[model samples]
Target: MPARAHKRFVLSDQPKKPVATAGGTFRGDAASFYLPDFCDSRAAFAIVLIAELTAIVLSIARQSAAVGFWGELARAALFLLWVGLVSAALLCWLRPRLARLGVGPGSVAALALLTLVVAAISACVSLLGHSRLVASAGTGAYFPRQLWPFVARNTVIGFVISAVALRYFYVTYQWRRNIEMRAAARVHALQARIRPHFLFNSMNTIASLTRSDPALAEQAVQDLADLFRASLSDRHQTITLAEELSIARTYQRVEQLRLGERLRVHWDVRGLPPDARVPGLMLQPLLENAIYHGIEPRPQGGTVTVTGERTAQLISLVVRNPLGERQAEREGNRVALANIRERLALLYGARALVKAGRFDEEYIVTLRFPYIASAPPAGGTRPAHAAPGSPEQ
Candidate 1:
């Protein structure tokens, strides 16, 4: 009689363990490696799709002659989707705080939270007249005996699955971070290459003027100073089209001091969105390439024309310079074009285009990139190749 009474006591105590002893909530900042954003619409959609697939698999794997296959599938789907969506919502709310706990603890807490959700849902369905859904083979009278076992089984399964999922997220996050760091490093190196080439050319231009015309040399120095100051002051990877044009014009002024009648420039950028964002120092290198190959070599100076227009989906820019009669001198070294192409690819992926070659009697370079409006609010848009599981700062 005492053993029977003790058994009843133990059974009664089992139900409370599912919720009460699962785990405590955690808190944290955004600096730590965390789970993906379940709050995002795309992520939520992915979760739904994966859950449905898992439900179908479970139904097929656990087939039994007594169970109605369609009914079993539907119930499994309903249970899984409920558990998934509820887990997503709970974790979405907890993610920012969880970031403070660091990756190891955060992952454990997330797994515990997932297990608790599964156990709670299983307990509810079992107790609230839905025991047939949980213990498919058990009758009404036998369901109470099956309830604790069902919840325990679910909690164990949830813990294993959640651990696998969290590990996958961490691996994915690390892979993406590595790719971004490499791209950033490559871009910085390419940008650095342009600076030394530009400085050497500008210094030569300024040096030529110092011997013939001291005042013009002084003015050139000022223009060169302004150019360097503008480029150095802004540290962002991209800048407004207007700002890039301003830098191009400053370069044009410095070139004009050296070339005199040989260098002529025309601007037709009225159709362009001055606020369109582009890579910093993008235009200056193109102009320098034009002057060095197409204009400087010929005795009679030629014109360099910059034309730009914005279409519905893209911003188009064209730089054209009259080709010298000597085909050898007119041939571009193409270092600048290659550098620009690499930078464009890094920043905008395949959305950016660059083509440079001969067009009629001109050496022309055409560039096209998606139209980006003026500076957005902080944390507004994700960058190309951005790592998942972390919000942009």
Candidate 2:
């Protein structure tokens, strides 16, 4: 049988691009639709703190009644604290239900209802205190007149404040979503530019192999087809560590056929978890850099060592290649490195790290990211090219 006939190519014809969720948040089920709005606890805390501080400052400035500055500050702080706590509690309770309604009139209505409830509770507490004082002073008749105005004032203030807070959050979310979209677009463009260069090189390698070793050449074509199929898929989607390593190995095989005895690869990926998820094409570019700069330049090619280490919270990968004399003088390595860094930032925010540097005669690139497992497909089968056991060294 021809090598092509023996090899199976389970390639996706047209993979849809991954759709980014609004505000860079993850998509949740219907029950938790509103959770993304509350995902940023730091932002929520900051908003609450600023609002409380503003209220305190305003109260101090408007003090013409009977209270001293310190006394007024204390009162204002206590009231605002109570209001903030109550609002947070209600939001926590209502968030999931509101999320199901989405960011629409229904969600806004829910927020308004919460504010009214808080205002009513505050007014009721104040009225009870006032009634006791009026009865003690033999002026219980004034309680009804005082109660209405107090309730009205609290209701108005509560509604206005809540409206403003919700608006601010909405605007901030939109701004962030815009920024993420722009960053994703730039990353996509960079990936596109990098692909042509990679394709041209791979084609050349296969062209050479075809004239010399037909069977290896056929296998290289299959590997190239599989690699391109993946690259053509959703650029924003993630893949498992096992799948990524499989692709890298296929790429290595293609390169080895071209460079023959000049190129060597040493993979030390045993410590890495196979199920850990990473952005697609993340490792392949680094390997390409290793071959282009590290191996191709030297008359006697050097080995590219890929090592991975996994801890409780983090997954770390290190790629080390000899700094060939010619590679030291190259100019385009920054493009690929920067692309990887930006993708990492988009996917994991501050939780991911990509650092590259030189140590003596070796060029090293290290990537560290929070460990996230890939979800299995419907069939529970491994992804294409991903084998069950440890990868071939």
Candidate 3:
């Protein structure tokens, strides 16, 4: 069946202006200063558990056989829980503002807030206990003797515990950030590997077409420009599914200009949600690999079949092309598969999947990733090169 076009690609026809390279550096700095998202349920639960464990340990250290020991333990647990929840809530609220600060300043602010919360809670608890002691003993003398000592001890303990916790958090954040940077570097490297080949081949095609078909050559040049523009974009962000498909279409058209009728494509993407967010340049590389390894080697090229479908939670895309000779399946094919697989895993964690192999007489590559809805085009309009019902090709 003929695929139905969605407004997504039409809207993306005018790609966002090329962003400056410094944008990435700025993003990195902002991200590095961000405190952990304390509002997250998992993070909140972790804080609660750690606070409870610390309370238990401290209570145990002071344990005695007296029945009042149980009361003390209970009070300690309740106090710690209150302190933990309050700190978490305050941090969650301050995270955005803190992220804007320099790393050193942000850390100091977070630590200060934590200490303040703990001290305030401890002071309240100590004052209440001192009042009760004074009331029962029928003498105000105990307040001066015990209140300050109790508050000081608890405040010092809270500061130590909070400092230790912050230290651990900083270490963990650094570790995770390093891992993310490594993955991003690897992805960029892989993306770089593909670009030179594409650039050289595309330039050569445009160069050859200049003499015979100047108009067609100009169009090819424009398509090549579009491809490179998308290539230079932020790979970490997602584009609309339609935009991704449009990029693939541009890549295919460029190949068709070079290979003529031999490079055929049939797209069955009616089932796809046009506004679904997908990693940028995701679909084009597969088509490029298909053309490079599958169609380019044979004297008579083959058709590349693309089909897409969306489930409630996932979106799947399948690319099929006639299998080339075993010798034609060289390093390029393997590199493309590995690059795509790694990119998907990095973006979607375990939820993304890539499967490739020969099925019957055709080579097939299937990709599956979680469905991500995109917001409506801003101002109720986006750049459009075609009508909503226009054929994708």
The weakest ten consecutive residues by lDDT in model 2 span 5-14
- Runs in model 3 deviating more than 4 A are 1-178, 181-195, 327-330, 383-393
List lDDT for all candidates, in order.
0.70, 0.68, 0.70
**Better candidate by TM-score, 1 or 2:** 2
TM-score: which is higher, 1 or 3?
3
Tens digit per residue, CA lDDT, model 2, 33-124: 33234335874686478657966797768763555566666666666666766666667666766655556654577668757775777686
Q: List where candidate 1 sits over 4 angstroms from the true fold.
A: 1-174, 177-201, 204-214, 230-236, 324-333, 376-393
Candidate 1 residue lDDT tens string, 15-76: 21221100112124563354788889998898899889998999898765555677667778
Error of 2 at 128 (Å): 36
lDDT-wise, the better of 2 and 3 is: 3
Q: How large is the C-alpha RMSD of every model relative to the true structure?
A: 20.9, 15.8, 14.8
